[model samples]
Target: MRAKIYGGCVSRDILNFDEAELIKLVSYNARSSLATLGSNNAAKNISKKHYDSLLNIESKFQRRMVESDFNNQILESAGKGDYDLLLIDFLVDRFHLAEIEGKLVTRSVEFLRSGIKPDRVVNTFSDQYLKLWKEGVDNLFNTVNNTVGLEAIRINKVYWTSVATNPQDSMMLNEKWDIEKNNAKLDAMYEYVENILPSSSIIEVDKNLLVADSDHKWGLSPFHFTDDYYRRMVKIFNA
Candidate 1:
């Protein structure tokens, strides 16, 4: 039966990759730092045309993804995430779990509408939870600290879908983004994002979370997938 994932994309090559080959590159250097440095100056951190200049990039695809403004928007959001206090309030007020919830403290959420991601949102917020909450924001720090956190949100794909050339949606294409406005917001937040949670978490996509019984759905872009990708995703969810 046909499904969201393409079963045909699967081939002998993919099936044969085994455990080691699939996860080899998942462990990488500081991908989180790039997100923190996504202001106008982000271009300096990346390599331009490979072999054309002194800085030749080994992986052009990865570099292009890093240089894209679309990616910058996604990363900065996670880097300055401060939804914990709101989440806790929801649990206590809405779910009526205050008795079991125990001690809680208030934090300023004025940054929400101001387009300003407060300084050290993840690190600082987690630090407070050390006494109040049951758990620390270590994973939260790890999420923003690495590219995988940005990938996990899945909203990035939606953002790319909104901006990228698509005949299906011409209206969205016409909506011009105010580059200067976004850059200002990003510039204001970069300093705070520099300090983040440290962890040695291994990426486990192809080896565990992302695999298919039979499908060639590798990927079209960093986030967007093809028919085969969706098909394989269905297989993963089912598994």
Candidate 2:
């Protein structure tokens, strides 16, 4: 299976895992939102200052994803129909958008860590944000129908884990995130997307599988789950 992924590492990690050797990742775009993908802005490139800061990012894949988000090219590869599946998870949508020089870019964790400030941050909860998201979602639905069709699309239904394998990690997640509130917002957004593509496949995992990994490569985060989670996800995908 050739797959193109958008949003976050959940799908990518699953496809990249040894258990998922039959699945080949065709393209992976991250740190982007549905709201940014369908935008037409004058400056499609990131500012030189931002690009310079991006160079310091430890992972090359992350740098490329960040650039892709700024360039608004998240859906470009998927249009060619080279991939059989388009896997999407909305963890990246949690990152608020930052408006810089009239262009709205995802204020990703990498961008935040880089210390490059944007002109303003747009709150995701605002009515205007929802409006933009809806418009983007419409654009995505049409594009997929014209290109890969709805059957090839998969929405990886995921949420922040309220618990972690390690007690320390669990405490840290609670300290940093209001899990219940954030999950509520995510559920609403996911429901909106599901409503748009009712025929598309929805990848659902047991709620018990949503436990954070204490030894995850990216460190403990609510969205970064244990190896068991990825394994179960792959099994579900195959089924």
Candidate 3:
């Protein structure tokens, strides 16, 4: 099945390694929060090409994600009805938003590293953010139901692991991140989304498998889970 993914690497990483190619990634928009989806393009002063040259980022995937956020193209593409499935996770919701050119933008890692500072940064936990996020979620669901149907969607209830599989390896995440706080926010998001979506469409991972992989290809991070975690996800997808 062809799928359009919106969120962080939680679902994308699993499909990326699917040896059987059970699912194909038709479109992907990452490092983008729900708050930015229906808003105006964030980078109005600089052209995308010229802006890319200024950024120190090397990963093409990250660059594309930044572009998606800049253009607010998640719903633009999702409305086209080109894919059979749409998978969404709230990992990017952990990111704070920025106000640029009077538009809310996802203050993603790539965007921060790009050197284009914003007029203001808004915390995701703020009341203003909650209002916008709820509206965005409503818009997203409405768009999907009108075009792709709700049955074509899946929500990955993702959370960061605080433990490491290897005892010797560091269990600490990036100094900037608060594991407990982020997980709590994720809990709220999961609850909010689950309340709107059907339980059958939710992809739930075993908490027992929530351990960081020291030898992960992307290096050690709370979200960089061990092999068994990925294996379980694959089984869920196949089922």
Candidate 4:
């Protein structure tokens, strides 16, 4: 049976923005009221074209924020915290914590019936399985994007159906799902911070502000990864 497309897998278009330009626009908006910014007479000192550009930029930025929130929800639900429950919800359509606990009970029973000791099996699985599962899921997501029409939908539907029907196998295939989830979340958070922050905000200032400070003041020095000023900004934001 084909699995219904869970809202989790639906891809929504995200707005792409130039961060530096967005910062400039925000500064401008702060300095002037929206009416003044839109008024031909008030903004006459600034090119009408420039004001119009700001409107376009702001609209796109707003759209991006909505898209970002949607993407975040999807990501968080996919396999982040409580992902097991999310998967179970897709499987059973009942999201109560007790229901999920019950599913776990069922799974444990099946595992024991199959002659696998729950404790032994859990301990024996390695982290490598989770890595492979992550790679597989990413590949499937990318493939869904690359293909089109009924073929893409059918492939995704079957993939999720297989996952739902074989919960124990999926769990076994991704033994360290929790760890992988944390890693993926950290990577996404870092990317979000990197894209939004300003370069100057993250650079370490020496006592004299003349030399780069080498001390690991914030647990990890931002400069360790790349000298790219923007990356330093991301580290500062993360810090």
- Tens-place lDDT per residue, model 1, 1-239, is 11111001221222233333321111111111222222332223322232132123345543333233212332344444332110000111010011101211111221122232222332322333222222222333454546334223211011122222243332432354332333343333322322331121111134222222222244322123224434353343234
Per-residue error for 128 in candidate 4, Å, reads 3.5
Give the clash total for candidate 1.
10
Q: What ranking of all candidate models by lDDT puts the best one first?
A: 2, 3, 1, 4
| TM-score for each predicted model, relative to the true structure | 0.19, 0.89, 0.89, 0.19
- The segments of candidate 1 whose C-alpha lies over 4 angstroms from its true place after superposition are 1-20, 24-136, 139-161, 170-193, 197-239
Give residue 148's error in model 3 in angstroms. 1.0
> How much lDDT does candidate 4 score?
0.23
How far is each candidate from the true structure, as Cα RMSD in Å? 21.1, 2.3, 2.7, 23.9
Error of 4 at 188 (Å): 19
Clash numbers, per candidate: 10, 0, 0, 0
| lDDT (Cα, tens digit) per residue for candidate 4, span 1-239 | 11122222110100012233221111000011011111122212322332232333234544333222212222222322221111100111111111111111112211122222222121112243233223334433333334421122221010111121234544533452343434353344234323433333122322121111233232111111112323333233234
Clashing pairs in 2: none
What lDDT score goes with residue 141 in model 4?
37
